[model samples]
Target: MNDQNPPAERRLPPLQLLLVSLQHVLLMYGGAVAVPLIIGQAAGLSREEIALLINADLLVAGIATLVQSLGIGPAGIRMPVMMGASFAAVSSMVVMAGMPGVGLTGIFGATIAAGLFGLLIAPFVCKIVRFFPPLVTGTVITSIGLSLFPVAVNWAGGGSGATQFGALHYLGVATAVLVTILLINQFMRGFWVNVSVLIGMALGYVLAGMLGMVDLSGLAQTPGLQVVTPNHFGAPTFSLAPILSMCLVVVIIFVESAGMFLALGKITGETVDPQRLRRGLLCDAGATFFAGFMNTFTHSSFAQNIGLVQMTGVRSRYVTALAGVILISLSLLPKAAFLVASIPAAVLGGAGIAMFGMVAATGIKILQEADIADRRNQLLVAVSIGLGMVPVIRPEFFAHLPQWMEPITHSGIAVATISAVTLNLLFNVLGGTERSLLTGASH
Candidate 1:
C-alpha cells in the first residue's frame, strides 16, 4: 500500500476535498454571517437590504478565507484557516452603524482604518509570542474551550430564546447526533472516523427535516439571483472617534488572534515564531481592509472552526481554500445560502460538545509538558485560569471600568495571558532565590 499520510499542506482528492470543505463551511456558517445580521437590523434597514448585507458578508468572508489559506507575499498563514467577521468588533460596528452621522459608510471607514492599524501593530503583537510558553498558551486555550461551552449549551437549548428553549425534543435530537458521532468515531476506521462530524450533522439535518424543525420560509423570499458588488453602501467616510474605537477593537482582535495562531501551531505540529505570527496577522488585516471596500465588517480567524479541524483530523489547507470557493458561490445564490443557513444551531451544538471539549483536552496535553510539578507553576496555572473564568461567569464584572477599557477587561483570554505571563516572569524569568517564596516553595 502507498503511504498516503502526507503532510498537512498536501491537497486531498477532489471528492474528498468537497466533502471536507463542506464540513468546515457548515461548522463556521453561523459565526461568519452573524455580524451583518446584527448591524443590518440595528441600522433599521429593510429586509431586502439586510439580506444583501448578509450576501455581501459571505462574499468578503470567502475571499478573506482564501487569502489566509493561500499565501500572498507577506500575508496569509498558509494553513487550514477559515476567515469570518470578528465578533470582537461587532459591538463597536453596531454602534457605528446606528450613530446619527456615522452610518454604514462610517463603519466601513473605521473598519478600514482598523485594518491599517492592525497591520502596523502586527509585528509588535507577534513579538509577544515568546512570552506564551506552554503554561500561558495552555491556560488561554483551556479558557477558550471552557468559554465556548456556554454557546453549545445555549444552542442545545434552542438558541437564545426560541420559545421552545429547553424543549426535550431539542435535547433529544442533539443527543442523538452527538451519540452518532461518538459511535462512528469508535467503530469506524481511517477516513470514516475522520469525517464523523460531517456524517453526524447529515443525520441531524435529515432528522430535523423529518420532524419539520427545519424552516424553509426564508428561502421563499430569497431572490433567484443575488450578486455582491463593491461599495454597495457607498464609499467609506473616515472620522477620528469611530476610527479610534475600531483601532481599539482591532488591538483586542490581535491579542485574541495570537492565542489562536499559537494553538494552531500546536495543532499542526508547526512552530509559531514571531515572523509566522506576523504573516497570519497581516492576512487578517488585509481581509479587513478589503471588507471595507466590499461593504462588510472586520475579519479574523473563525476560531470555532479550529475545533472542527481538530475534531475531524483533516488538516489540508486546500480543503479550506475550497470551502472559500463554496462560500463565494453561496453568496451569489441566495436560495442556496438560505438552505445552508437553515441547518439548526442545535445540530451544531451537538457536535460542538465533542469538538470544543477536545480543545481543552489539547491544552491539558500541552500543560503536561510544562513544569506542572513546580509549586509556583501550579499556583500560576490555578490563579490564571480562575481569572480567565471571571468574564465567562459574570460578564458584567468589568462594567464599572471606562468604556475604552471594555476590550481588555471583557476578554477572558487577555486576562489569562496577562496573569500567566506576569507570574511566569516573576516565578521563573526573574528568578531570584526569593522568587520561590513569592510563590510557594516546591519539592
Candidate 2:
C-alpha cells in the first residue's frame, strides 16, 4: 500500500469531529463571558448595562472566532482557535472609564483606533514569532494561567466589591462545584471525561440554585429580545490620551497572541508559519475594531481554550465557528443571554479553577519538551516564571511605579515574555564562545 493510503484507521467520522468541536465550546464558554462581566462592573454600569455589554461582547466574540478559525481573503489563521475579549486591555479600559467626559464613547473610539494600529502592525509583529522558542512560550502561557487565578479566586469569594463577599453560602457553592468537577473527571470516560468541566458547572448551577445561592432577579427584569444597534453610546470621540493607551494595549495583545499561537501550534502539531500568524493577528485586531463599533471591547484568542483543545484532542476550527454562532444567537436574545448571566459567580469560579489549571499544565507539558538539561535553559525558565508571578502574588507591588509603566508591570504575561526573551537572547544568542559552543552541542 502507498504510505498515505494505509492510514484508514486514523481517520475520524464527521459526527465524531462535531462532538469534539462541541467539547471545545463547552470548555471555553465560561471564560469568554467573564471579561465583559468584569469590565461592565468596573465601568460602574447598572445590571442592565452589564447585560448589554455581555451580550454585545458575546456577539462580537463569536464573529471574531469565526473569522479567525475560518480563513478569509488574507485575514484569518484558519485554525481551530476561539477568540474572545483580551484581558490585557482590562487595565486600559479601567483607566479609560475614569477619564472625565470621555465616558463609554471614548473607550469605544480608543479601542477601534488601537485595533486599527494592531492590524497595521500585524505583518511586522508576525515576524517576531521566531523569537518565541518553546521555553519562552511555555513561560508566557504559564504566566497567563497564573495571572487569571486571582480573578477566579475573587469570583469564588462572590466577586470583587460584593457586599456578600466570602459569605458561607458562596464558599459552600464553590466547594460543591470543585468537588463535582473532581468526581466527573475521576469517573467519566472518552468525550464525557473531556467535558467534565461543563458537566461540573451544570451540576454546580443546579445545586447552587437548589441551595438558594443562585440569583435570577435580573433575568426576570431583562427584555425578551434586544437588537444590538451600533453606536448606541453616541458616535465615538477619539482622543490622543485614550488612543495612546489603547495602542499600548494592542501591542501587549500582539505579544500575548504570539505566545498563545505558539502554544496552540505545539499542542496541535501544526506549523504556525509567519503568514498564518499575520492573518491571525489581523483577525484579532479586526474583531476588536468590530467590537468597538458594536459597543464592546478588544478581542483575541482565548488562551484557556487552547488547553481545552489539547485536552480533548479536538482540532476542528468549525466547532469554534459553531460556538460563535451560538454566542451570536445569545446576543440577539436578551432573555436567553440574561439567563446565562444569572449563573452564580461561585459556579463560574469553580469551572475556571479547573480550566485555568489545565492551561498551566499545558505550559508544563511544553517545558518538558525543552532542552532543560543545560543549566542556562533551566535558569531562563526559573527567572522568567518567578518574575511573572510577582504581579500575581503582590498586586500592589508595582503601585509606586510611574502611571505610564503600570500597564507593562501589571501584566504577568508581558513581564514573563520580556524576561524570557531577554534572558534567552542574553544567554543563548549573545553568549561567549564557550557558552555558545555548549548550547549548540546540547541542542
Candidate 3:
C-alpha cells in the first residue's frame, strides 16, 4: 500500500484494493444507472428493452472507467477516475427520442458522431475551457437541471403513460423517498452520506413492493446472466441535428472533465502537465466514441468518485481499475438489470428530484465563483437561463425557425450554452476589456 510519489501511481494489496474499489463503485452506482433509466423510459422502450439498455450502459461505463484509470498508449489519464454516462447529454438524447423519425438509433448515431468530434478536439480542449468559464458552464448546468425537472415530476406522477398517472400514492412514495434522502444526508457521514440517493431509492423500492407497486414479473423472465453485445438496439441512423446537439454536449463534458482532472491532481499530489491533460481528455473522448457502438451514451469522469478519494485518502488508480472490474461483472447479470428496471417510476422520481436538484445546486455553487454582482455578469446568467428555458417551457418557440436549427433550439442545455457563450463573448470579450473576462477576472 504505497502512498508516495504521485499517490495515484502506487499499487495496493489485492484485498485492500478490492475493498477500496467497492467503495468507489458504491458511491457511483446510483448515478451510473440513472442515465440509462431516464433515456430508456423516455424512449418508450419495454421493461426488457430498458433492462438491456442498463446492461449496455453499465458495460460501457466499466470499460470507460478502466480506460480512465489505466493508461493505454497515450489515451488514459491514469488517475483515480471512475467514468460513467454524462448528464449533459441527457436532454438532447431525450429530445432525440421524441423527435419524429428519430429514436434510439438516432440518439446512438449522434453519440458516435459526437465521440469522433470530441476525439478530434481533445488536444485543444484545454483552450476551449476558457471560453466556457463558470459563468457559462454554471448557466448551462443550471438550465440542464431545470430543463429535466418536468421529467422527474412526470415520473412522480406515475410515469407519463401510466394508467394511474398522478395517483396520490405515487406522489406520497416519491415524497417519502425525497425525505429519506434528505434525512440520510443530514445525519449520515462518510460512505453512508455519499450513497444517500441509492439508499433512498432502495427504500422507496421496498416500500413500493409492499404497496404492490413494484413489478417483479420482469425479473422472473430475465436470464440470470447475459453477455452484452455491441449495438444491442440496432444499427444507428445518423442525422445532422442530433450529431450537432451531441457534439455540443461533448464540449460541455470536456470543459467539466478538465476541472475534475485538475481537482484529482491536487488530491493525488500529482502535477497534471499538458501531456497528462491531453491523455485524460483523449480517454474521455475515446470512451464516449466507443460508447455509441456499444449501445450507450457519452462517458466522462464521475465527480462523486473524486470526493470519495478525498474523503478516504486512497489515491491509487489501481483501486478504480478494480472498481471497473466490479462494474463489468455486474453488467453481465440480467437479473440485476431487471431488478433495477422493476423500480417504480414514482420511486425513481423521488431519487431523481434529489439527484437532478443537486445538479442545479452544483451550477449555483459554480456561479458563486463568477462575479455575479456586476450587472453584465448578472445579465449573462439571467438572459442565458431565460432563453434556455424557452425550449423547456414552450417546445414550439423555435417551430418557426428552420428545422435544421432544432439541434440548438430543441434542447434547453444547448440553447443555454450557445446563449451564455455568445453573450459572454459579446459583453466580456468584445467590450474591449484588456484582461479578458473569459479568464474569469477583470470584471
Using lDDT as the measure, the top candidate is 1
Question: Mind giving the per-residue lDDT tens digits that candidate 2 earns over 1-443?
Answer: 22342121123456654555555555566667777777777778887777788788888988888788777888877777888887777777787787797778899998899899998999999998888888788878887777778877877888765688989877877788778777867787766765666667688789889988667776666788887879876898899988888888888888888888888787766788898899999998999888889989888788777766665555656667776776788788888766666777888787677767777888887887778788999999889989989988897899998766666888788889989999988876677456758678643
Off by over 4 Å in 1: 1-6, 432-443
C-alpha lDDT of all candidate models, in order = 0.83, 0.78, 0.78
Best by TM-score: 1
Please say which candidate is ahead in lDDT: 1 or 3.
1
lDDT of model 2 at position 328:
80
Q: After superposing candidate 2 on the true structure, give the runs of residues whose Cα lies further than 4 Å from its correct spot.
A: 1-47, 161-172, 432-443
Superposition error at 93 for model 2 (Å): 2.4
Candidate 1 lDDT by residue in tens digits, 384-439 = 88998888789899888777767677777777777888898888777745756677
- Count of backbone clashes, every candidate in sequence: 0, 0, 0
Q: Which stretches of candidate 3 lie over 4 Å from their true place?
A: 1-54, 69-73, 76-114, 230-281, 295-327, 434-443
Query: RMSD to the native, candidate 3?
Result: 5.8
Query: Each model's TM-score, in the order given?
Result: 0.94, 0.88, 0.72
Clashing pairs in 2: none
Q: How high is the lDDT of residue 34 in model 1?
A: 79
How far is each candidate from the true structure, as Cα RMSD in Å? 2.9, 3.7, 5.8
